[model samples]
Target: MNRQLTNSKLLLKPASASPALHRVLTVPQLWGIAVGLVISGEYFGWNYGWAVAGTVGFAAATVLVTIFYITFIFSYTELTAAIPDAGGPFAYAYRAFGPMGGFSAGFATLVDFLLAPPAIAAALGAYAHFLNPDLSPQWVGAVAYVVFVSINLLGVRDSANFSLVVTILAVAELLVFMALVAPGFQLKNVVAHTDSFGWSGVFAALPFAIWFYLAIEGVAMVAEEVKDPRRSIPRAYLLSIGTLVVLAIGTMLLCAGAGDWRQLATIDYPLPETLAMVLGKGSVWTSLFASIGLFGLVASFHCNTLGYSRQLYVLARNGYLPAFLGQVNERFRTPHWASIVGGLIGLGALFSGTTDQIIIFSVLGALVMYIVSLLSLFALRRNEPQLERPFRTPFYPVMPAVSLVLALICLLAIVYFNLLLSLLFVGLGAISLGLFWRFGRQRINVHLTTLGEAERH
Candidate 1:
């Protein structure tokens, strides 16, 4: 029965009474979504070393690292313009490699989304300690998860607005920190190095650096939601990436100027610590500002949860999984159930292990998704040469090829430093492939039989 359904093209037709699936999200809203992914405490802890190293290791290399993110955004913009659909990686994979490949891409992306929220929530909880030293980390994490999920369940517009407000505040807080501390900038502090930069240190730091830039592609996930997605997505993508790069670099400089490199590296939440040092322990204003920035980091996870759930819904609708997940909430016009399911998975992560462990797994999953996306782009171009594309990736073959190579290097670095996390990802992929083959074959058979019945009639 499922096989017939899978093969049946009749179900693919749009329903007359069915409202348009695509929602017209504004440019700022789209930008908020991208920012939600990029602006986080996780970036602060993990990528500080990489950004500093990139800046000082080799001047030209730092520039390349900065440009790498911009280049990636442009490439993804082309993909979004070509296929402004909800399935995201799933849709791209489907068009490029067929059903099995699509299922794997979609499944892997779902894993990445499911793991991200809890990790972010935990990070928020950890940072919250800087404010209230006595609060329990688990309680903080749980409260954050509930609050963020509640906002998303309310509606996409509400969530987007919340994200925008938080991002604005977060950016403001960072700017304020920089403004107050920039005067203290010392060249001697900027060049201070505790550890030597070699192939091993660079490789060790690769996973951490990739984690910082991991979610830039998140803009592509919401392609269908944006108004004039073709233009809006690209603009939002480039703008958000640029903003994040500047914010990251400036923050690095502020930290360097505020204290020694070793001291900055040792502290977990460097920004707040730096603020506390410069303003003194009794400064309530700086503390409040730092709290707002932490709130923004929490909001970023909320945005990620929504984006991932919607992509899962699109995948389910395409016969890659259970059909029930595709149902949209009539009142909210959001995927309420899928969002809940995603939240549960995140909550489970909180119970499953330590925050550091989750971070490692999340980083590994993101790298795999990036590699697949890069390859999918190339495959689609070769397979569908005549397909209409509103935005074309310049230097097509070469650009994507370069992305692929960089992704591989990042992946290798992950495997080298974190074999256990790498193995878990591989295991998850294998399970997803097995499920897809079993379920997809059933769908295909049902679809074929339905076609035969129609012929007989």
Candidate 2:
């Protein structure tokens, strides 16, 4: 058994089970799933940047962030195709750098996936409250968590189908917003409102700019469930990002142009407010936009739960967490336990009622994951030159190098802008990893031993 482990074949071995995570997602469903995980950002969270850097500053930050993501996503798809693990970057790092590296990468993935849903939930709750002033935002969000987790628990096909429906509504909502505000869009509005937040302000806005495309990579977490991953994954990834870039730019320009930039700057439902300016404050169109806009938040909250559970499921299956977390519902074939727990955590964070702080911490985790995954790309290329790669990142070292440098810059800027919060994030992550290294190490060895025996038979 030990001799067989020498060649790293054991690393790819699955625990004794029928193939897990049903492959019900098709190319179109995957595209919707990918877009759904991120569309909410363009609708709400990115507006927060205006408060920090104004329209022009945030737009500059966004353009740079878009470049970072384009390069990063293109590079990242290569890893997804080659590895195609539900663990995503964790699996990539594990195959490249061993346990400790895997833990760090997995931890970062956990942080982002776990933290992001709460922010979206908060937005969901806010949108619900906007439509009906009597409803409690917190309760609305908590209900959404329960309902979506229930949906997710049913099965992957059901979840993906739900995602496709809501994702279409979300995209349609954006188009409606664009049409209503298109005639109102004036370049002078952005020009007149642009503030000199300086380079510092631009840096400060990086996290919010990131909100525009955050979690788009989450599609890779469902790699095990794709019909033809090697082809479908790359197509879904490229299309999703391309769609997001167009929506983001259109949304930003129209929103900034339609009203006082400050009006939407700190709001949860930026589009409705921008629409209010064009269509009258208390108009039916404004109310309709507000009601339908929840789909975007719902889309992200629902799909990100899918990503989170899969990441948690893979980690536990690999012995980085309690083995029970990896358990699938036999009837449903879904990661029911992980989904429930992740949703509960998001509910807890939503109770804090601080969206920006939650977002910053989440972005911090994403930044770390991005850097680690890119490193894994280079490490695997150098160490396992013969490993079959279905698709190679177009520019090789240059693309990843660009991604790394941009991600590092964003990380530094985030740290600089939110020193204490960054410190708290790093401290919590270090403590979690330290505990895992001390206690979880034995579990990994035992699991591997069992796996090796199972493979021998």
Candidate 3:
């Protein structure tokens, strides 16, 4: 067995269980998923209220958050280009910290991915209120989950196509709304009305602002599917982040200008409400537009699940997870079972409660993963100087360091705002890490031994 374990084939060959699926996602589609998930107008209105009340200026806060996101994407693009693998942050963590760290990162990501679909579905359900206020939120969430899951289960090609369509419609709607409302923008609204520009408001608004800037790395999750990952991944990251920041600033300006900040703060769906007031009941178009945005959210959720499932499949093939999860659907040429599992998790989250709780939990988990990923970038650079890096992080250690710091700040803000809930999430991740180390290590060892025996013969 020792001799067999030394065999070059056993050491270097790819796992038989892992098969490359269709690479159908274009840079645009990747951008769509990243932007769509994070660029919700409703979230901005809901959370930015406090920011408006406390910050020196809404635009300044937007700019600060956007800069942080820009730094994050740069770091992510470099990492994704170096390791264009399915596991994303999981792959990075494994390379930098080892199996335990990898599993923790993957587990955290899974928590976020599992919660995202349902949270977005519930958000979509809320937007459905615009179309038909009587529509049951639960049912709306259920329907959206089913529809997107179906699209996802169909395979990557169809899912990417659907995402592209939703992205186009959503962007167009925002542009049109901006074009119509830009003329009515009032200069007075841009002025900071209160004396809330100190550390208190900045710290208070940081979490929600970070939430708005979240999901910028969703495209990195599908790094393997990108046609020219080295180039496309970075391009998509920049384009998506840039576009989202612009849209956010534009929407904030338009909404603030058209209506009082206090009024916008009180609105459940600020954009639509502002539009309705400015453009009349027909401006209720914000609802349809928001529905489109929700559609984009569903698309993003599907793509996210698809990307993460493939990551799990790779980890399973590596003996870090159950081997059964590594199996691919020969018929669909996708990770069908994993996709179904993701859908079920989303369904459960949808039934759990309101969108806010789901978003908080999902954000908490994602921030943990992001923090680890950013740290991994520095660790890998220090430990593996000879590693082939197709694309180096442009700002090198500085950008990644900044990203790590910002991620920590965001995590702290989450804890500060939602103390008990944040503690619960951290506790859950800690328990998961303990379980993976205690039980998963033994299984991986056994699998390794079995592979060694097979190689020896």
Candidate 4:
């Protein structure tokens, strides 16, 4: 009773004292941010699926994954427009299932956002190594972490501008790559190169296929900072996903058509290598490909680091993590502490070294969030029908229902192929939830109750 009374007193704290985030991003900046966050997927990682499933099999898996993402993004827009919080999926899950659900969604989002950069950083390292062959890829990745994180810490506008520049260059590089490879694209290459794995290979390829469109949902994380979220968030989400889908399909086709899909499947820097095959090794085009290709990886590495920091900030703000991780820098007006901590974690993960491993593990976390979030959509519709929604998902329940089912199918396929990673993901999630239940609940309960009281007062 004494503890409850004390909690009530804490819950009565004034709303004016709460820390606030800056609102500075617009729709175009959000396009840059969203595309930049996932464009690296188009450049690398997805090719690895060819090794597992062959070109046709990988393409099949990609088609399926694309459906899931399209539906998922359309449905996700409603949530973002309705509740524009940096917490993204966590914000939706929290409203539908309360504190425990929020932590789970937030934790899984952390896993997705945090693990992705090291993989992209490793790709950046590989690109650097391609140019000089002397600089260690690991060290190059470490340097990238330092440089991009510093840019992000400087300010959100600076970070968004940097992302815009890199994203354009990255897109331009892909266009150049497609043009160079267009002459060499023979229909026979894809048919002749089909691996023995066949249909089963499609299932094995599911996680890698996801690389084509992964992390695009990250746009929602910045809804809090958007100038007009209801209008802007939905536009950004649809446009970015549409752009990515066209690019993913075109890139995959051109890549397989240009050379033996078998050889392209295993390399870290597939684009330069594909260019080398078509334009000749050591040619100026290959070198240009190597140089400009870094921008694609850089764009993703930089933007995702930004996403991870905001996620950490959201977690801390909700009292699911340490309060210090939630602090916005008065000088830069960014989440300085959260960015630094997330960078340190990404830097430490550089030692993992395997891009595919990091990517598969990261997808597992996203899969969990996808499941919970789709359920949240259902829960919210039933539980809070009166809630104001500026943008409604077209097709109502069908879009989310299809997205949820496809997500589950993809998750199962990925797990079937990656048993060890799936087990590790489950173990980590379980342990984290156990710890949160034991201790973090008190803080979250107090925080939520306090917000409610403040609103009442």
Q: TM-scores across all candidates? A: 0.88, 0.96, 0.88, 0.95
Q: What is candidate 1's lDDT per residue for 7-102, written digit by digit as tens?
A: 223234221233335566888988888887767743354534443353254223334445556666667777777777777776677666667666
Q: Which whole-number lDDT from 0 to 100 does residue 372 have in model 1?
A: 72
Candidate 4 Cα deviation (angstroms), residue 244: 0.3
lDDT of 1: 0.68
Enumerate clash totals for all models, in the order shown.
12, 0, 0, 0
Where in model 4 is the C-alpha error above 4 Å? 1-19, 452-457
Clash pairs (backbone) in predicted model 4: none
lDDT of 2 by residue, 1-457 (tens): 5332422443454443624778878888998899999999988889899898988899999999999999999999999988888889888888778887788889999889999999998888888888889998888888989999899999998899999999999999899889999988888888665755777889999999999999998998999888989989999999999999999999999988886778888878788888888888788989988988989999999999999999988888777877778888888999888898888888888997499889999999999999999999998899878877888999789999999999999999999989998898889888988889888888777767776676779
Tens digits of per-residue lDDT, candidate 4, 1-457, equal 2433332233223222345666888888899999999999988999999888999998899999999999998888888888888889988887777776788899899999999999999989888998998999999999998898899989888888889888988888888888889999998987775747688899999988888888898988887778989899988888899889988999999888887778889888898888888889979989888988888999999999999998998787766777788788878878888999999988888886488999998899889888888898888888778878988989989989999999999999889889998999989888988888887788776765665576679
Which is better, 3 or 4, measured by TM-score? 4
Better of 1 and 4 by lDDT: 4
Best by lDDT: 2
Show where candidate 2 strays beyond 4 Å: 1-19, 453-457
Q: What does candidate 3's lDDT look like per residue over 394-438, in tens digits? A: 868888788788778767866887788888887887787777787
Q: Note the Cα lDDT for every prediction shown.
A: 0.68, 0.88, 0.68, 0.85
Q: Rank the candidates by lDDT, best first.
A: 2, 4, 1, 3
The C-alpha local distance difference test score for the whole of candidate 4 amounts to 0.85
